[model samples]
Target chain A: MTHGISMAGYMFVNPGEEILVPSLFWGNYNLSFINAYDAKIKPYNLFKGEGLDVAAMGAELMSEGDKKILLLNFPNNPTGYSPDVREMKEIISAVEQAAKAGKKIVVICDDAYFGLVFEEGIEAQSPFAWLANLHENVLAVKVDGPTKEDYVWGFRVGFMTYGIKGGTEALYTALENKTAGAIRGSISNTSNLSQSLLLEAFDSPTYQEEKKEKFNILKSRYEAVKQAMKNPDYAEFFKAKPYNSGYFMCIELKDGLDADVVRRLLIEKYSIGTISLNNLLRIAFSAVAVKDILALFDGIYSACKELTV
Target chain B: MTHGISMAGYMFVNPGEEILVPSLFWGNYNLSFINAYDAKIKPYNLFKGEGLDVAAMGAELMSEGDKKILLLNFPNNPTGYSPDVREMKEIISAVEQAAKAGKKIVVICDDAYFGLVFEEGIEAQSPFAWLANLHENVLAVKVDGPTKEDYVWGFRVGFMTYGIKGGTEALYTALENKTAGAIRGSISNTSNLSQSLLLEAFDSPTYQEEKKEKFNILKSRYEAVKQAMKNPDYAEFFKAKPYNSGYFMCIELKDGLDADVVRRLLIEKYSIGTISLNNLLRIAFSAVAVKDILALFDGIYSACKELTV
Candidate 1:
């Protein structure tokens, strides 16, 4: 996934160019875009009342220079929020508005957690599917693979696919060659053994069924977490950020509670693991079995209470 | 191997810095250093009397700025030349001379074709071993792995090792962390499955013996090529460059014989494959069996004649 992003960074942005990233984002984005490309990051508000801030994204897009690289990751890392159907439409509309205003845009759809959405209302398809052909000026570059979808974490196999409204075969071929050139200039190529294994796995008779089974396991965990978060006792500690998909969801800690302190307490005292990003406590429910979901939240609540005392 | 070089390029050289390369060199060096890091290539004469021009190398290092990046490839690509013990000493002396003159040098030992030496006189150990602890001013970085040694091309597994004079564990750890940071900023990590498999292969009882068997096969092919080159009839067409190891060897076409023309003729009339780099025709003896080496050389000779006609 990072290889694809690195290539995209090389392909699109020049040094010192601005890339619009969410204020709350995957930590590696800093390394991929800012560190590698020397591009400046312009952070925009990610959420408006527990949903994607589509209007803020559009406003940020317009406020920036005419040439913009807008990176969207969903189901997003750290937050684990995928846009619902209505939110997806709003996102497309926002990007479309920018394109209509004659802004040249490269929308990077980091669909690392593609097909992992648990809820029915959520948009199943990536923003790549919608914005790829929505506007002539917007180029949708989707970076995704089975690394997460197939639960093959360390395979290091991902793909960079380009799409644009009215995109010709020649255009895509050129983009592909350039991407290949970028790759050639760096690591040469990805592991062929990993690629062949993924190919073989795709051809297996139980591939779809197996993926469905794994998704169901994650979905049950998501359901359990959702149920557990409804406990009124936990509300005084942190408010669970609106989440319905992917591996994790964040708890926006109540004012005056340091997430890191709570996280350390949870680790040392309660033996629970969680990532603390400022006040947002990210819990990767995917790692924990469904049976452990309630205990996990209860542990966090206890940690918070202990910290307060 | 390319990944390690890419990391080295990032670590050592700043944009527009000059990297000293051999006049005859691997093509990918341009992509790795120049394209990726925006560094400049300063090519020094590679050969004097069919042996490495150690004097020219030393002179170039002395002539350059105080900081220099000296890249060396042994059992080198296309030329298949490895410095013998005497030549290796001269090379070391040259580097030591530069280091003594207050030059800060980063010697990149690209030992991609390590352990493939078919001759007795050649220096079996890499220059990395010699120059690494030679001087405090010199830093030796060795990029190598089972990719070539074990012939696992598609596995995409390689290692980057660092050595320096009076090096401490802390310094090495710092360098490693920086390299790891660079990797994290790009591909994230290598394929774990490929790594696990290579680990398993290394533990096998016949690992050393199997490697020896493969070496013997290549050595036999190398011997055949050497024998075939002794044919007096081929002397008029081209001069065989001094070569003893690696997959390939280059033949410098005699004046008026275009390498591309001879290559085409070989492909069309004789049904043989060879790479043309200006006047040098590279043949991969590693791919050709011992039984076919004579025919391969004869076919090249025949193709040269046809081109001349």
Candidate 2:
């Protein structure tokens, strides 16, 4: 997925050009966009009132350059949130408004967490589908893989698909050749053994059923996290961010309580690990046992209390 | 191997700077140094007569530039030639002389075909061992992998090693961090499954013996190719270049014969495939069976006759 995103930067943006990502995003975006391509990272607010800030996205799109790169990842890392159907439509509408205003937009949908949604009423499909054929001026590039989807973190297999309204075979062929050139110049090629395994796994008779079983296991853990966050005592320490569909959820620490202080306390006192990001504590519920979810929260609650004193 | 080379380009060479390569080097050097890093490729004559041109290399090193990147590939591609120990020392002496002349050098030893030396009196070990720690002003970088070494091409596993005189752990660590940063910005990490498999293969009791068996098979093919090239009939068509190691050998077309025309004729009439580069045809004798080696060369001879008529 990172390879794909970095290629987008190579293919589209020149040095010092801006790529707009969310304010809270995977930190590796800095390495890919800035370090790899020498492009600038322009961040926009990700959320407004527990939903995607479509207004902020639209504003960034129309604010400056003739060519804009809007990178969207969902359910995003650190703060797992996937937009519901209405929000998806609104996001697309905002992009459409920008495209109609003569902005040449490249919408990169990083669907690393594809099909991991655990909640109903959320649009589980990738937004690439809707934005693909929306406008001639807009190009939708999807970077997805079985790394997260199939639990093969080390396989390092990922893909990039390009979409544009009225895109011809010649255009896609040219784009593919350029992408191949970029890859050929770097790693030579990806792991063929890993790719063959994925192909065989996809063709298995029980593949879909097995995947569903695993998804249900993670969904149960997500439910356990949701159930534990309802505790009244924990509310004073931190407020849970809007989350539904991925492995992680963030909690915004209240009263300026140091998240690193709480994180260290949890690690030292309770042997629990959580990533502290400024005022946000990202808890990867996927790694914890479903039965231990409540105890994990209790540990965090105690750590926050200790920091308060 | 490419990743390491690209990283060396990224870390050491700046844009518009020059990277010295052999005139008959691998074509992908263009992609890695020129396309990826925007560095210039300055080619030096690889051969004088049948052996390596150490004088040409020395001349390039003492050229106008203060900092020079010298990339050397042993058991080199296209013309599979590795230097004997005496010639290697001469090459090193040339570099050391240039370094003493205040030329800061980064010598990249691309040892992709390491351990494949077929002839006696040849230096089988990588030149990196000698180049490393030779001088404080020279940094030796070695890029090699199991792709060719262990015959696991699809696994895509390679490594990069750095060495310098009086280098401390802190300096190595800093270089490692920068390399890791470059990888993180791109593919994130190599395939863990492939790496684990390579580890197991390395640990297996039959590993060395099995590898010896495979090496003997390829060596037999190389011997068969050498024996078949002794046929006087082939001299009318092409003269084989000096090759004693690696999977490939090149034939320089004789009497102004078009290599592509002969290649097409061989493919059309005899169904034999070979890569034609200008007046040279590269044949991978490693892929041909020992029993069929003579026939393959005969096919080429016949095609050349047809082309002449």
Candidate 3:
């Protein structure tokens, strides 16, 4: 909440400035900016083939007068999509053009599900490391938390870093003071005990090794989910999007079926709850067991067969 | 911060409504109500004889019109002074009359330093238990936190309970829903880890025993401070107010001696820091060692002697 508020405060984009957002975006992005910051969010429909709709993003940026900020999310929420190197370069070029055009483009990468790319082709990179030293006009604000990565949902421990010109020390000091002021004015400070616990965990010798093991287990489970979706009965109900990392996968419902109807039937009749986004349903593969994935799909398939339009 | 915002949000008394405040009030109250709520703060000046000016409080209540909220703090900050039974009764009477006048009076008892009353005559009680059930109009809102009580400053863990006409269940449910909504709108929720840790601490058998021992230690330290303040060199410098609980005490400086001047000298020359409120210099006994109490006063006394006035 603190980080979100801080980022929203710094977003000084002018009226009608086109900020590119993927069609498959987190609901909170709209809530945080359009609803909260009162900035315009121009949605670029995602490219059918890979990661982000880079070509569409570039065209949108060129079409709009001047881009002030480009919002990016990797290992994306609700879709579990990560842009490959080629697509990333195209996105970067569009951002560079915005920067060169004298529009102070603040790239806010909401890396909430960062470092969780699972698919064979998809690889993740910290945008902070990539764009921090790039240009004076191009500032990258990275918002990441322990909620997803460290499996500490209740902790609410997150940090925001600004990559700007001048040494890291100067940038950090200015950002820290502003951030601390925001914190003091809002919630005062994060839990002293939570910070202590996280510090302890980070300093622990086994943390990295244990985290890697957990990541591998999640990856295997995701693979199982992908393999199970290929089965005949479930395959006919929906088309599974290529998901490399993160907990969720987006499944496009069949033409005649309603995603919300399927979601309600699955929950009420089958005791399964999944999130429906328009014509798509997002299933969290991380929570369900590998052995149970097939059974869960079978149940969903059965419900769809009975309740389909 | 959450409690502060909630209090500010609901503290919308009509233009003529009187809100009683202590002379040595928390700074935030001024910001929250006077500046924000636009409510008038009628300060009941603390008497030099009695730690709390309860007689003045009662007189003010009897004289003023109805529709008032009496804000009380015990084991008070910047002056760890709790009122005796006589003073407590006067305050109770003041509240009772306000209730009888058909005024919806809220007795906001900030029990931040609760369970720390050390003196025999200056014991503390849960005002909610006493005054809340007295009249339907007399509502008691007890705002306390584990931050100070549990020695966890950074946790930002606080609880608020409403004493109302309904049974405990209904009151709790209403309070919970309102507070939870406030929390949701502000920071979404408190740190889950902090809540878990606090719950664990409360459930532990040895927690109370350990806390009692710490309380005794604080009590002893406060006693030492009282004895040191009685020293002849310091006694004449300022009027000593009775401090039985909490972390601090305020010394009423001589008529001509400026508190800021004294505070500055103490900090600059002696490397000691204390807060100043007009003519009063607040000394925090909790942060300093017991044995160092006399020495600290000695520094203050010498600083006072050096002043030409």
Please give the CA lDDT of all the candidate structures.
Answer: 0.90, 0.89, 0.72
Q: Write down the TM-score for model 2.
A: 0.98
Name the lDDT value of residue B95 in candidate 2: 90
Q: Interface RMSD, all models, one decimal each? A: 0.8, 0.9, 4.2
CAPRI-style grade of the A/B interface in model 1 = high
Q: Which ten residues in a row have the lowest lDDT in candidate 3 chain B?
A: B3-12
lDDT of 2 by residue, A65-131 (tens): 7899999989989799999999999899999999999999999998998889988999998989999
Candidate 3 docking quality: incorrect, acceptable, medium or high: acceptable
Accuracy of chain B in candidate 3 (TM-score): 0.90
Displacement of residue B227 (Cα, Å) in model 2 is: 0.3
User: Model 2 off-target regions past 4 Å?
Assistant: none
Per-residue alpha-carbon lDDT of candidate 3 for residues B18-38, written as tens digits (9 for 90 to 100): 678787876656544554335
- Which whole-number lDDT from 0 to 100 does residue B106 have in model 2? 94
How do all models score by TM-score?
Answer: 0.98, 0.98, 0.80
Q: For model 2, how does the per-residue alpha-carbon lDDT over B1-309 read when each residue is reduced to its tens digit?
A: 777777778788888999999878888898888988789999998888888899999999999979999999998887888898888999999999999999999999998889998999999988789988899999999999898888888898889999998889999999999999988988888889999999999999999999999899989999999999999988887888888899899999887689988888888889899989889999989899999999999999888887787
Q: Provide DockQ values for all models, in the order shown.
A: 0.81, 0.80, 0.27
Winner on lDDT between 1 and 2 is: 1
- Whole-model alpha-carbon lDDT for candidate 1: 0.90
